[model samples]
Target: MPALKLLKLPPPVTEEWEWQMNASCRDIDGSLFFHPDNERGEAREGRVAAAKRICEGCPVRRECLRYALESGERYGIWGGTTEEERRATRARRRVR
Candidate 1:
């Protein structure tokens, strides 16, 4: 019988997340970053723009972006970038 191989797992969620403590959006409402159900067009665009504005002054913007890209975060703005922006970045990386 062949021995079963174990899959390598990602690090625990509790690890190296301290940057969140210094984020500019830390004191803001989370709903600002995430849209409500059926939100679309100008409303969603406005919300995303507001979130990115907050991220512009974040002390941990780089770290937040790295985490989002690494974790495949598919919603909300991070590091001043929208979900569409992140998706484009991922696509570019894959092409490289």
Candidate 2:
């Protein structure tokens, strides 16, 4: 063998996207977004409300909502919107 050459590959890309920005719920318990199936009524409402509050203050709320809608996310609170709210958004989008 006369010579062997190796080509260096560029560094792997690790830039964060807008959707990957720090979230307000980063410090919150994930369980709050995915409450127990047995949880109902006032308890569930309180949990959902708390999660939504975090989402309300999130800087990437719109991106979060878009991600949720595009992914067809059917569970948990996202972008301060409940599953029912997201359903309405989808319906409205379809009408447009």
Candidate 3:
């Protein structure tokens, strides 16, 4: 039998995630973007609003949203969007 050949795979692209370095939330507490267990109502909404405020001024906001949407991120606030918001966006995309 002939020698087996190994498939060559390209290295992961780190540059694709470089935008995270410039994200406004980088210096802030991560908890602001992720609700704690048992969190509810106004408290969760307040945290989400605060996180979105930071995202609003982020230079990489669009890139962040694109990444989250493409990666199917299912938790936390990403690119100014809550999990519900991302779900809605995905739903809209499916309908189009």
Tell me, by TM-score, which candidate is best: 3
Candidate 2, 1-96: lDDT as tens digits:
778788999876655344545778777788988778788899999999889888887988887788889999998888788888999999999999
- Pairs in steric clash, model 3: none
**Stretch of 10 with least lDDT, candidate 1:** 10-19
- Quality of model 1 by C-alpha lDDT: 0.90
Q: How are the candidates ranked when ordered by lDDT, highest leading?
A: 3, 1, 2
TM-scores of the candidates in the order shown: 0.82, 0.76, 0.87
Question: Residue 12 CA error for candidate 3 (Å)?
Answer: 2.3
Show where candidate 2 strays beyond 4 Å.
1-18
Write candidate 1's Cα lDDT for 45-94 as tens digits.
Answer: 88988888898878999999999999999988888887889999999999
Report the Cα lDDT for candidate 3: 0.93
Any residue pairs clashing in model 1, and if so which? Answer: none
When summed lDDT is taken over every stretch of 10 residues in candidate 2, the lowest stretch is 12-21
